[model samples]
Target: MSTFEQKILSTIETNQLMGSDQSAVIAVSGGPDSICLLHALCNLYDKLTATCVYIDHHLRPDESALEAKVVETHCLKRSIGFMSITVDVPAEAEATGDSIEACARRLRYNALEQVRSDVGADIIAVGHTADDQVEELLLRLIRGSGLKGLSGMGFKRGRVIRPLLEISRQEVLAYLDTHGHEFCHDSSNESVRFLRNRIRLELLPVLEQRFNPAIRSTILNTVNILKQEEEFISAESDRFYRSLVRECTNEKDPAGHHSISFATESLTTIPAALRRRLFERACWETGCRPDFQHIDTIDKLLAKPVSGTELHLPDGVRVVRQHDSLLFTKLTEDQGPRESVAYTIEIGQEIEGSGSYVIPVLNRQLDIWLSDSDPRDAQLMRIDRDTITFPILLRSTAPGDRFTPLGGPGSKKVARFLGDRKIPHHLRHLHPVLESDAAIICVLGLEIDERCRITETTTQQLHIRWVKP
Candidate 1:
């Protein structure tokens, strides 16, 4: 076996990119790197099965057909399976407002995944050399990426594996020449319009000659160090997310949206680095493509006393502060305003006896009963039955509402009262308030009126409990 084939086999073994007797879908673009990978894998037919998939991004209408034929002919000569697909990247880019490069990459990977599934393959292999890795590191660095992005591409991500990650472009070209194999050159690679092409053709050569002859190796070393550190941070981030963040289901539109919540108070306890990673993970889980500006904005939001503040981000994501918690939600097209709609709690004759009333608006249930003794639960509120007249009025808070909390000095506006308790501004108006004979009784889940508190001479005890879903 040649040195290139030995390196390929070694990389596969070291990274465990694929197991013996497994099937792989190879992404072949008829380029030197891809053709090299396909030829090497075909030579290892004893270890695994390989299928070639050529995806035409429709960017080069004149050249794409010929490239597909080249790859197909090579696969046929090697007695390997081959598939061809065409994706309209331009249409997708226009529809999603993404750059042509970004859209093409997205569609290419998606097409490869679909092909892998259709072929019942275990993994999808792509030819990404060490040169590509160096370029990627520079690209992400120029684009202002974090540790994870700076770490560059991995040998294996999900079902996609890059067996040529350790090989150089020079090595790939040498191997193709030795084997006397022909490959197509993409005209786009020579265009300086794309940042990657410019970096490859201009920046890389200049850096190698003018700055350091070993710039590629230096960048690869930096990527290796960053990848190790990022792995440790990623593991810690996962631990913190599992322990601190929680997924919240919207009962009204459970299938339409995705949401995640974490306590705002916990932000102070976490390191800034981990916090940013946590935010990114939360955004990704909720279907948002997080960026540096969005994350920085969220960090600033945490430092301010901006309860109920909200930020609408890309991909229809909405981030809001609700009292003590920060919520990340992927909003659907039909998702209406997040402001809580005003609702009234109608207490029927059930309030006079033991019964439960569902508060659909708040996704909570209120339980009331005339008790002979205290429930002793902190969540249960004990009231003096004789102190207030029934035909109790339960409704959302209104302006000018006032209540004297139990053991409090005097009455205060309901708005200020809730504010003091750190209730979110948007939810202050939606907070449930109980009234008896035009006298404010209590704010559920907060404090009860001092006038309605159970006393030593109280004859009847009224119990109120709030249950949340």
Candidate 2:
């Protein structure tokens, strides 16, 4: 059997990588590794039904087009379905601030997955090889990574598969050349500026030449051994997490924010390793994830177990130890508070829009002939033409999140005021807070804009009302 044929068949049987009954999409970049991968899959096309996807990142427009044409021609000559997608490279690279290598990798994978889903392919194959695996292992060590990072990439990730990961780049090139197929050369692959590039060009070569000739084989062998250890550790971590965490909600309200209950004793009982996992999961659940150091600090604090101690972590993630368990929240730097939300009445315009200012016409002012007498006697705040702040702040409400009263002429915390007024607990979270600079204007219908009370200069009026829906 040919060398490539043996490798392909072995990978399929050993890894349970592919089944003849299924279809796949190969992400071919017109490079040797990808071309060899596509070529190998083509041998099984009759049984497996595969297509080729070429992602044309518009970096070097001419080069990209040429590469796409190469892949298209190859696929077409073999009667395999081929497609090319173009994405703006420079804009995306700049937006993400990724190095050329990083940007290209991100765009390439995203485009490939999109194409995979679009084509209804059960598997998507990539072209990583043994040399790439060793380089990655070295890179992960130098960058200070945990066990998960050190474990390297999986042979199968979600719907994506790496068929050539066990082979070397030289073997792939030899296979392609032996079959008389040409492939594009990626110039950036030779650069040594990036750390991975440095490892690939500098360290890997020296290790092979001077000390260990089987470094690539050794790396693969270690990964093969660790795969089972990694899987076992993962299952233990998950089991501990599931047994401890329980979600509680008092019926999800408008904002979709709900209450959850947990035990500190239960959380602390988990092994230290499992505690870290729980902390990370908790942060993600609360729309944030505390950084590594913050997680470590929270884990340490869990030992002594105190309540109400808040730790502000990177990225605005805050954790509060309440009783035994911890609660995660978004932190806000103390800034000058908004004074008030105010607006003037337009002659006959709707006051409803995205702004802090309220210019609602009172129910008393509307003609029974022109408007229905709203059952709720919620009086709309009126103002003169001079009082409105253009483009005011209209936004969602907060917990322990409050507003200042307009007619009452004082600031009241939202939670306390709502509870005192007996506003339905479910409806309070949906209440919109209108603000200008320092104080709250109106709790929509529950209160009025303080600085914008009906004044002597008020000239125009219309009927306006707030409804809970």
Candidate 3:
């Protein structure tokens, strides 16, 4: 057995990458590293059943096809099962709003997953070397990554195993040369436009020449240390997380918004590092991005002694500090049953303006206004007929629209009122408004104009109802 084959076998056994007599899918890109992996896996074990999958990202027209053909011929000569799949990476990138690299990676994994399911493969093996790990560490560092990100890629993540993670690219090329193996080189790796390529080709050589001659080994060592430390922290954080989270309910309100609560005192008692981890956990569970600034803002909120403080986080999540608990709730969409399309409504005429808008009769019997109204209710205000004009326009909120919000000291900008309420920016245009004399009388599903409020002297009322969608 060659040195490369022996090293890979040892790495696999140490990592327990695959079980004895297991089926594996090898992702071969016709590159030196992948070709080495294929040969090593095939040569090292007879019990292991392996197949090759060549992904044609369709980025390069002729070169990509040639690379696939090379991989196919090699697999055929070795009596291995081979499959070539084509993906429109550029089209997928445009559709998903992802960069070319990100989109290609996502689609490639998806295609591999499909093959894994089809073949009932126990694991998928990819040729990611120590060089890739070093590159990733630097990439994450430049991007301001946290501990988890800094740990870099693992030898095994889910069903994907990297037997060559401990091996260097130079070692791979040497192994291929010793075996008289032919491999296809991707020219894109030389392009400076891609960050990874630039890091691999430009930054690495300069660092090796000037700073550390063994920078790759240094990075690998750092990654190993950090990975071990990060694992300990993550496990401890999860243990504390379950205890800190007092209540988690998905069926809280009618809208099915998820709510999670943590004891304020208990949360603050946690170590600063673990506190960040716990907050990150909450953000992940709530489908919110765990941005450093956002997490810091939330962490700072825990220090405030005051209660009833509310913060609107990204992804419509609202964090509220109660008396003894911190509450996190994903705000439900304010879409009401009423359509927000603007149309003029005549007095005493009932028109189904939108799904939420309805004109109810002036009962004046059942006192719906005697008690505090549900702010989310889409009910029409009781405006005196004589005090208002014949035609009251119900339209989507527009610029320059102002309203005297009920119980407010004075008139405020409709936009300002919506902003104060923590309404999401995208949903602002869908908010309905009732206009009279070029003035906003009602900001539907929120507040009615103070002037339109019912009084004892009022003889007639125009009841407008706004229902939550």
Candidate 4:
């Protein structure tokens, strides 16, 4: 067997990335690395069925399609199954607020997975080589990544495998030359606008010429050591994470936010490093990006053991403490106060999002008759009809909006009031408050303005029933 075939077989066996009976899907882009990988896999693993896939990012419309055709023809000439997909990476980048490269990578992986499922493939092989690994290391280092990022991409991540990770780009080109194989050269790989291209074309050459002649090998060795250390730490952290976690529940509402709780005592006992990793994993599970500041905030909360403490993280995920437990929920944008619609209502008019009804009743007897206790009585609020002016403005809590909650002394911030009730920070915006002539007469669900409380002398009442949509 040739050296290229030997390396591919060794990488596969070392990682145990595939089974002999499994079919493999090769993500080919008609580039040298992918072309070399497809050729090596076909030659080395005759026992395994293989398919070649090309993803057209649609950035270089005509060029990308040509590359796909080259790859398709090569696959067919080799008698291997072939497939091609096109993605609008620029439009996706705009829609997702991600960089074009990031969006393209995400869409590419999604498309690859879709093909994988359709073909019932066991593994999706990619052509990421040691050169890409070194470039990624430098990128992550500049971005302030921790050990996990320093480890670089793994040989096997989920169903995606990199059979050429241990091989270099020079080696791939040499192998292709010896085999007399043709492949397309992507012009984007020369663009300085992309960090990877800059590193590959300019930075690596400088480092190799001036610093270390074998910088690529040196970085790969470092990544290998870091990856091993990371694996041990990850396993230990996962063990501790499972021990500390008590329950995870999702809100039944459409927002689909999750509620994750950990034992406060057990959490405080964990080492700070492992605890941070555990919290980071939890935040990632909830689709929130865990930063140092947010992780530190949670660490402080765990040490202090405050019952009602809460932290609002990025991505609209709310973390609330209920006694000894922490609840994580993703607050939908529609559930937030920023999306609130401001409107004025007269007698018998209803609030828009709050679903509260305002009905004018004649007397205390009529108030009791209309307010026969329903299952939703807890959401109902009663106020003296004569005390409020017409056209009361119904809106979400504004900054500095203060209200005296029922049976409470003095006024507190609407935000603070909601926090005290264990409301997820993101949902507080949806908590409606009624402003009558610039005075807060009610907080839709929790309390009625103390001044608006119905009394014995009040002959008429404005009955408000809070309903959730």
Candidate 5:
């Protein structure tokens, strides 16, 4: 066996990248690293079920075809199963603002995944060398990365594994040279337009020439240390999220919004380190990864008086303090108080004025109109027409109001009801209320006035239903 094949055998065994009988596909890009991976995998084809997939991202139309042909010829010489897939990337990538490198990489990986599934391959192999790892570390360090970013690419990300990370690019090139197989080179790699190209071609060589030649080793060390710190940070973050959150039920919407509040005492109780972790993970979980600026904003919010103060975060996200708990929500600028349309809903007609609006009145009888008839019998109530105050105003909940509340008694103030239920700050403004400019009428799906209950001597009955668009 050649030196490349011998090296692959050792690394594969060490990493448990592939068992003797297991199936794997090598992702060959016709580049030096992948070309070496293809050859090494082919050398062990007798022991392992190995195939090759070449993704032709149609950047250079003629060039891709030529490369695919070369890969096919190489595989044919070895009697290996070879699959080549073509994908258009340049136009689409430019439209999406992704650099050519990034778009091609994403497209190639996706194609390889589909091919892997089709071929019943358990693992997909990539040829990422120690040189690539070092480059990534320097690149990430330059970009102002945190622990996650500083940690260079893992050997395995999802189903793709890089067993050759321990190998050097020179070692792979040496093997290809010995075997008399020249790999396809991309001309775009010479361009200085992208930062990565300059880093890989110019900065790395100069550093290796003048500075510590063992920079790659320390780069690898940095990644390993960062990974260790990352694990501890993630664990502490999970603890913080668990420790600081409590749930409150919203009665306005049965499929109610969840209100997550961080108790000031609980937050203050956590160490400063844990506080940072808590905020970081909290932002990530809520789909808004708070940057340094956002973290500063959060810190400012924490310093605020613990009343009902709120802050609108970037990306339509909001952070608010209600009493003792901090809440995060996705909300927008109030669209100038929910465009109201009061057309005096008539009976026996569907009024699609503003959402599911319909008021059907009968001579002491019943008329119902709702989006779903899936029996909210328990949530439904009757009202006496004479007892109900007229000029019923339909609007979102306001402060200092009281309603009997569905499935409850003795009338709870609107603010108290929302607070006890933990209605999310965003939804609180959107929750519909029905009030008669007097006492609040049944807060739509919440409750009906005791005086409005249908009794023995009811003359007229108005059936009102709440709905959505």
Candidate 6:
């Protein structure tokens, strides 16, 4: 085996990047780093199955096709599987308002993940060298990144492994030359419009020549130390997270939202650093990508003496400070607060004798049927047929909407009832309440009105269930 291939094998074994019987989808970009990785992994086909995937960013249409062909030719010669995929990075960037670089990276990883899943591969191997790691660390540092960002990329993250991460770009070129392999040079890499290219082509050379002669090795050493420290801090953060955090499954809260809650007192007891990490963890659990500003804003929220203060965050996530707990909720796009429209169901018309009536606007369905036996499930409300009036109205709560909850002493306003149950303020108006000609029948998924409750003397029972998606 060549020295370069031996280095890669050592790195793979040391990190346990892949199992002996597992297969990998190698992302070959037709560059020296990727080309070298592809050849190296293919040479080890005796131990593991390998497939090559070329992701075309569609930035340079003419060059992309040629790059794919080069990767395909190499795979063909090695008798390995090859797949080509094209992604419209420009269109996605325009749609998402993300920069070209960010969009391309996102779409490229997504495409690679899709290929990995399609091929049933155990892992996706990418050729991110030590040089790339140093460049990434410098870029993130210039952008004012924290400790985790300074750590650079991991050797193995999820199902993606970087086998050549310990190898430098110069070493990659040496390996390619030794094997007499040709690779494509992306012209975009020379363009300074992207910050990364500038760092690699301009900043690093100056830093190496004028400042430190071994700048790359120095940065790599710093990143390695940071990664180890980050792992330890992350472990501690996880310990606190598991002990303090709890998923909120409150039935009164609106559906189609993810929520997690932790006691505010517990947050105060932990150090500020761990508290920030916990905040990030909570936001991640609710599908939010929170930055430093978001975490700082949440920290400010923690200092407030009052409860019920909420701040909107990216990806429809909202952090609300309740009386004793902090609630992080990610609302669905369609679940935003809106004026609820009234939906009506006439006893024998819209909702026939025994059938389900869907409310498309609310994304809910009402299943009503006649039952001789009483409903034991709290979700299924068994009402006395004689108490209900015709043409039931399903509408949001109004000023005068009041109902005596089952086994309650007196009538309570729907708004106050929802507030008492800890329903979010934005979702209060969206809570569905069934109203008959005379009074409010029930608050769906919560409690039925006392007057409509089935009694022992009642012979006929009508069971109504509200289903949410």
lDDT of each: 0.80, 0.64, 0.74, 0.74, 0.65, 0.79
- Runs of candidate 4 with Cα error greater than 4 angstroms are 246-256, 304-306, 332-469
Candidate 1 local lDDT, 1-469, one digit each (tens): 7777989989999999987788999999999999999998878556568789999998999999999999999988887899999999989875654678988999999999988888899999999999999999999988788999999999999999999999999999999999998899999999999999999999999999999999999999999999999999999988887778444333333656777777888876899999998888877887777777678877776775757766555555667777887888765433322322112244321132233455666777666656576545887887887776544667778889998999989999988999899999877644688777667878987889999988889887777776663
**Candidate 5: C-alpha lDDT:** 0.65
* Candidate 3, poorest ten consecutive residues by summed lDDT: 362-371
Q: Arrange candidates, best lDDT first.
A: 1, 6, 4, 3, 5, 2
RMSD of each: 18.8, 16.0, 14.6, 14.9, 18.2, 16.5
Top-scoring candidate (TM-score): 6
After superposition, candidate 1 runs with Cα above 4 Å error: 246-256, 332-469
Per residue, candidate 4 scores C-alpha lDDT tens digits across 220-279 of 999999999999999999888776654444344455556566666566677888988978
lDDT of 6 by residue, 1-469 (tens): 7776788889999999987799989999998989998888877556668789999898998799999999999988888899999899999875655678988999999999998898899999999999999999999999888889999999999999999999999988888888899999999999999999999999999999999999999999999999999999999999988777453332224766778888888889999988999899888878777778678878888877678766656555667778988888864432222211112343223221333455666666666655576536766887887786444666777787789989998989888889888999886654677766547888877889999887888876767777662
Comparing 4 and 6 on TM-score, the stronger one? 6
> Which numbered prediction scores highest in lDDT against the true structure?
1
Clashing residue pairs in candidate 4 are 337-429
The TM-score between candidate 4 and the true structure equals 0.69
Report the poorest 10 consecutive residues by lDDT, candidate 5: 362-371
lDDT of 1: 0.80
| Alpha-carbon TM-score of each model against the true structure | 0.69, 0.65, 0.69, 0.69, 0.62, 0.70
Error of 1 at 293 (Å): 0.8
Q: 178, model 4: CA deviation in Å?
A: 0.3
Runs with alpha carbons beyond 4 Å of true place in candidate 3 = 245-253, 305-308, 335-469
Q: Tens digit of lDDT per residue, candidate 3, span 308-364?
A: 766545455666777988777764434221212122222333222111222332211
Model 2: how far is 142 from its true place, Å?
1.4
After superposition of all CA atoms, the RMSD between model 1 and the true structure is 18.8
